[model samples]
Target: MGIFEFVANNIYYTVPIPVYVAVLVVLLCQVFRRIFISRRPSIMESTPLAHKTSDLSHYILKSDSCPALQVTPDTTYSWRDKPQEVPREIKPGKYFLTMNIRKLDPNDYIIFDERFLSEYRERQAIIENVGPGKIFVADPSDGGALDLCEETLVVTVDFLVTRYPSMFRKTERGVFCIDAGEEYDLVTRPWSRHPLEITCLLSGEDHILIRCCDDGTLRVAAVGLVYSLNIDWRSFIGKELGSIHKDAHVPFYESALQKSVDRYFQKLPPDKLISRANWLTQVGPELRNDNFPDKYLELVSTLPGNTITPETIVNDLYIRVERQAMRKLPSTNGVVFKFRVYATNIWDLEQEEGIPRRFADHIRGLPEPILRQKHCLECADCILKAMDFMAEQQEKEKFMNSYD
Candidate 1:
């Protein structure tokens, strides 16, 4: 009563006491509701960063659980009706396209989605950038890449003919018909055209064939690597698994993960299929090396130093995710691996509650060997900055929530 009397007497000499008391009551209710009744922002809400934020959020926010490998009965990929444009790096005048693929926690072994249009568009762009010569490098003497190329073509044609005969028919010229104007000679083709057909049909997906050597080691035989990140296809074509993953501490005999990987390959039956995902971040969309068709060595020669700034790392960075699928070819007894690459901005990470903190924690906790293998030393400062910024934001949110 004293408080009310004081307010009524002192608020204003001209104002009515009842009107002032009513306004005071309304103001108090609003403050009380704001502090005690409202809910905080939901962690699962869609972020402004990417259209598929909700889908990607499930993977980013948690350590993926290793699920049982399932067989994908056929190769009829669900195609997106429309293809969306992804960002590419901008060089002063020249344009360079890049796809980011990073190491990921153990997740589901394989994924088959309707990505026909998306894959076709990216494949077209890759072809235009790299051309046929570099995109499909299969020398009969090199053996594996070309052999795998042929096998992949056969499988692709078989799938098309069997599953979607309306879209694929047999031509009188001994060619497989895609449409009235388009026909592919899967049988009589030169070694080169086999890879071409594989690329044409599996537009968005990149292929690499691995075969066991006489010495009981695995080697990368052939790769339809149109969207490679940093590494050249030629360099990896004939390399062993250990040599390929040397930087990541993957030892054939020593590391348990390495041993399990080998065991998985050895035991993977011809009809069984398995897949996994890997993720990484880069400063910009210009990830694929400029060595697509030609000038690989030239591009390597002029490559920039590994120096990067926190500002650039934070502002220019984006996430790169690769969905990898592996299965054994019943005929050749060789394993085919598909790397389907996708990119999303790191800002997507900000959308999930506790994600930024989790990312910061993971990066901070990385061991020296793993850190070096990730090539994260150069971007360490920027990455750390991002982590810290996320932490600060989280702290501010917590403080605000405390009142509620």
Candidate 2:
């Protein structure tokens, strides 16, 4: 019999309806599994989100095998507190203010660096709202007059004011809230209250302006950077500066800070010189304590150019210093510094087109360092040095193998 006819005849005689139904059910189950049970791609796999913020990808620290910033919430900033004063009332004029609130995850906020502000000058307020730190404001608006109002300001409150009083006391004369239909002539009452004004004006939109509460209130405003006064000062002093590790710690801290400063300068653009100057005053003390005044000042100086030589030196010094510090640490089991170093090196290598493919391949093939291993001070130093040496050797090999 022909194959089709024989099969048809056999099916007609032996095939059961229940058997075919069972087969159909199995196929349907598989289709359903494929539709519902498979894992979807993550945000990183998705199309790049708007690069409207600073490209922090470069700033991300990585190490051989560990994930990013896995430190527990306890070690980081707490976001559980609510603000005591919720800006219940804002009127025209200037004021000094602070909010009490939780520290948001890094992903939730945007960094408003000076370059970012210049790039999107039209949206400065918006950028400021998205940043992680405190901000300063000035108002050109004259009281509540609609035509007289200059700009609409909007500020988002995220943090809570823990120490400061929440209520506007009688002494707080410069601060007042205007009801929807209040009338005050700025020309007449400009000097009636403390000239230091805090204005909440409604032009087309609403904005809150906090003027300088006192003269020379140095507000260190920047995106990405948050003022962290709660750093483990004791741990740093003991481990990074104490007698047991003083020899290594002091030099390491100094070198690291210097490198960070150099890096800050190398990466900063010329137009941001003013902002850098402002930042230096605020962060300079911390940098000096950490032993990196040169790099810090260099960034503050605002020299022009995209040169990588200084940056390279900074990076080398940073690695050396970090390695030395790691050697003094109590333990490294969950430490992230090494992985950050490796990732940074990989990124730098990838940027150079002159690097040979074979050398790159060798680096790609090397096993990543295990981050979970409990890091003793010595172990941390060894791992960091090894990674740095490997990176350097890879670059050397790539250069040697490459054609001119």
Estimate every model's Cα lDDT from 0 to 1.
0.53, 0.25
> RMSD in Å for candidate 2, one decimal?
25.6
Q: Highest lDDT: give the candidate number.
A: 1
Off by over 4 Å in 1: 1-78, 81-119, 142-145, 157-183, 200-203, 247-260, 287-308, 352-354, 388-404
Per-residue C-alpha lDDT of model 1 across residues 193-215, encoded as one tens digit per residue: 44534544443567777886666
Estimate the lDDT of model 1.
0.53
Tens digits of lDDT, candidate 2, 354-403: 33243333233333221111111212333344445555766777788896
| Model 2: residues with Cα > 4 Å off, grouped in runs | 27-316, 319-404
